[model samples]
Target: MSALSLYALFTGRKPPSVKYKYYRKYFIIYAASMSSFAVHTVFICFFYVINIPILSVINVFSVSVWALALRENYYGRHSNAIFLACAEISIHAVLATAYLGWSSGFQFYLWPAACLATINPRLGVRLSSAIGFGCIVLFILLKTVVDDGLYNFDFRKYADFFYVFNGIIAGISLIFGICSIRVINERQEEKLTDLATKDELTNLFNRRYINSYLSEYEPDADLENRPYCIVLGDLDYFKKVNDTLGHYAGDDVLIDVSRYLKQRFRSSDVVCRWGGEEFLFLLKDTSLRQAHDLVEKICRDIPDNIHVCSSQRIRITMSFGIAASTGVSQHEQLIKVADENLYQAKKQGRNCVVSSEITG
Candidate 1:
């Protein structure tokens, strides 16, 4: 299970993600796993009159507390692995020490640890390997010195089988899990990259993302291969609404406009919040004329009515500018030209589209 799960992580899926809707399910898993720990601890207590190995039972309790804390309201990309690792720790602490059955509770030990290793292969390998080795050491020492009949030949026959099982599980998980870390890290890095480039409010790729995306767009072809046009847009009279109503109203307007652009454009295009009341778009494989038409459509379709503090309806408009970069110069040049044209649109009518003439 450990080996298969780790390998599946490499190509099967993009790791587990924590979403708000699944909050209840996460709690359920945590409860079940913690209950497993409690049950294991309880079962072990029956052997020595509820007094057999209280130390491990206590550790299980502590680990359960840690599990609850880690799995609480704190949801992230890697929280599942962390929770599973904690669960494994609790299970093993009880099984290895309390049950003293290396073959029983520890049977599925590799599964949870494997989950950790799968989610973060590199860190999982390094971390779980050390943990695995520690378990082995503890297993050998405790079995030989304490449980081996205090220097007598007792349960000695179980040593080889237990050691072999632990060795194989630990060795395989560490080896393969480490190998897949680079890939997992790459995916995580992509998500972080998306966050940095996307606007939190509207979820449109930001100017920064558009800039970097173009900068690293081509490896062999210089700036000449991008074939992208830029459109700069500014919300006209946006400040008046904020001053007249409130910033909340202005924010709602901005959200509405952003949604308009996102739904109106093609999937290949990127829309960005350039700044306060200003936005930019990267229209892939498009020309200046096409960009102009697109912006014109948005200008004509934008709703003018926005509700106010006293339930009064208000109207709004936007101005846009267009410029094309034929993958020949810096991407910023197109944006600058677009900005100039956007200003021209505002100057012309405050609710129109203007295309900037290419220079040089």
Candidate 2:
């Protein structure tokens, strides 16, 4: 399947269109909980083999806590799950450090917990940072106050191995938490970009985005000898539709027309919702004649293809005007020319295409 389909499958969200945000907290919590469960299960086995019944039983409780946290996360109780996870980690770290000493690396898990707290959206940044700082203070206290160990076990020989293993696991958890924060930031940036550049109702590029594109667009002089064309289209009697049929029906008509226009244009072309009931097209490497023909066909097809909105068949016509890039250095000049032609088309009569050549 496509990458978008795979993303939807994993995140349980459809592909983003206009304004869309996906909550990744559930995935992060679920993964963290499951990993914690597996790690504690391994610890339970290790402690049992090494004859530490207390630590083994503590690990059993850790596993149960993680399992419950996972279930809570699955049920959409994210704050509860996060609280459970943080509490379990804090308690388990202190207990493990007390039993096996700070050298065993159990206290390292507190670092990731702190990082997680700072990134959680539910907790304000100030409070989360304070919680993270508290974890750090707790870590320092445990290191200074805790004695070598409580139980004088015969597992001193395996101290280095346990230390290395727990250290690696803790490091991985920390890295995962950092990556989660990065992903959340990137997704937020994407949402902001979409909000700024896309039309909400039609999910088409907005006037601002089109203007930016025109400003930034630099033509490759060597490969692109042909001039591009700009076509401005306006829906005929659009105000009447909004006034008579209501704004809701007008929105449906705009959405349907936008979809149709997007499908009719080539992939290289830029289709934008210029403003209310108006669209702008940037046809790369297209002549005025070609643009006019394409737009004329669309104009004819719109009326024949009735748009059904709220059980009402709405037949709408569009007028288009085309202007080709002919020694026009400024993008605004080209758009102005296109707009003049569009006005001429409307004056002559609606549902027709007008071009610079025809007007000249």
Candidate 3:
């Protein structure tokens, strides 16, 4: 519907899609209503009563064309838009039918033109309606009132009412579009802010963000089991791949590693980029053993895909250290113990998980 509105507003220009759907049907119906008013009203003075046979044919044809456009506009359809469109169509259909009876459907087409005001909360709808309504009024005066050359339009006596009606339509489109644009812009900003805190390379929370969040997280000292476990893992000899293949290949390694962690861990587990060549996982509501074992599984599963250096299948491994939040006063305290264990894992042999609980 937005696309249709955008196109109509731009006089048949194409619009970009955040997502695509057909509200074009509604827009086309709207345009048809306005355009039809122009066509139908021109003849109202001659007949004073619409040709029902012709109107029936035109209405039926209009409905069919709208259905086709409706289907296409549905590519990005929302239920709300559908409901609104249906309501607008129903109202316009009834009014159009009545206009046919009075042979003045064109004169009243302004009513349906005003319906565009409801298309959105933007001021544009109301503005368009006003423009259209003004056109209708001018159409009425030029053809009917000025006929005797006395500058006497029949509706000139009630021009105030018509002007007010146009003003209302203008206000409606403007408010709706403004509100909708503001909300859409706000959402886009929020998504952008969220992206800023993420690691584009690994699709994980960046270490800076993790640290900031951790700094804000208050620990519970009285709990028997820890609230969470922090695991630090470093890829063993990661520099060798970069040194051999290139930075691009090294990026793939990081991506694969991140995916491996995400696949194995629960949704609640948070994986973060813990500086270059290292990663961190915060497992919520986990014990020391569970944390250590989980990290061990992740360390073991790092894919050594053939794409590493020579486009040949290769294996990759990392060493992990685990520490529970239990008895840890600060976020760094937990990381400190985890780092110690990680160093121990590296010393024992690469590609293993080391835990202080197991060492002593």
Candidate 4:
């Protein structure tokens, strides 16, 4: 049963562990280790290796204890189960090697265990360092004492069998541990990429992401002949709201506006928080006049009453500037023209839409 479970891990079918999702890889490792122990138990029982079956029984007992620890949320009441399991298994390997002789290749298991312990974030630095140093010291001592009569042992022809089997198990464990680490790193990279591109406040694409998108877009490469427009807008009197009510109120207003903007625009349109109280919209297959008309409608539909704190009722308004591809050669030029029109809207009293095409 244990051997079958171990095989599941090699095939990427991990057992379910809701409390220890991150440590679930170690659960697979534990299953594999238990299976290895079970094999040793069968081998020793068949050949009658003196006192070895007793040690294998103890190792099985250790696996049971670790399994209980995992279930009980032990190991500091968190998913540090892998670290604890690695340390326990490494210690067991050292003891088994000392008793069975280094010829059994049990010491080979220590290397992979130490590697896992050191790399795992769940394992404390001091604990990892101690285990790493202990493994190194034990390895050195084993190498030094192997030639002496005190350490030398022969299991007759069975020695070769034990050595080969142990080596294969150790190699498998190392590969599994390395692959787990790679999976963890890849997940972290994806999370970081999400955080980097998204705005913390409004959950919209930030200026950095939209700018990159615009920079990568090739105007001449539009084989489908789709037109696009840039609509740059900013909240009217947003700074006053921040100063009078508080930044929290300002945040509430931004959140409210962002939600409406998301609902109002097409999914193909890229709406971003350009910075501060400003937002930029990239509308595909839309003209500057259409963009302007859309913004004007959105400005009209904005609720007159927004709750800013429990007692304060605030009305929010936005000014927009539109620019289309027909009048501009590149996004940079379009953005500059749109920004200038945005300035014109601000100058023409707060809640209004201005376009470069109108100004031109």
Ranked candidates, highest lDDT first:
2, 4, 1, 3
lDDT (CA) per prediction:
0.61, 0.81, 0.58, 0.71
Instruction: Write the residue-wise lDDT of candidate 2 on 1-360 in tens digits.
Output: 477744543453533321223347777776788778888999899888889988899999999999788766655677778878887987898898878787777888888778767766678989999988988998898889885767646667877877898788889888887888788889889989999999999999999999989876624521355577888999998988888799998899899899999999998899999999999998987777788788889889988774655455556999988888764346677788889999999999888988884221
In candidate 2, position 172 carries an lDDT of 89
TM-score of each: 0.62, 0.74, 0.55, 0.61
Clashes of 3: 37
Q: In model 2, which regions exceed 4 Å deviation?
A: 1-23, 34-84, 121-152, 157-161, 218-226, 243-245, 309-314, 357-360
Best-fitting candidate, scored by lDDT: 2
**Of 3 and 4, which scores higher on lDDT?**
4
Candidate with best TM-score = 2
lDDT of 4 at 240: 81
Ten contiguous residues minimizing lDDT sum, candidate 4: 70-79
How would you encode candidate 3's per-residue C-alpha lDDT over 243-308 as one tens digit per residue? 877888898888877877777789877789888889988888877877777776666556543235
Q: Which stretches in model 1 have alpha-carbon errors above 4 Å? A: 1-29, 41-133, 140-195, 218-226, 304-313, 357-360
lDDT string, candidate 4, 1-360, tens digits: 367554543443444432444455555554654565456446546534554454656566665655554433322343355565566667766666676677777778788877867876766899877777778777777667752223334453465687798888788888987887788788889879879999999999999999899876635424455667888989988888898888897898899889889999999899999999999999888877788788889877775634456456556788888887763357878888889989999999968888865232
TM-score, cand. 3 vs. native: 0.55
**Model 1 lDDT tens row, 18-113:** 465444434434434445445545544543353435434545564565445444413332455354554455355434533444433244345445
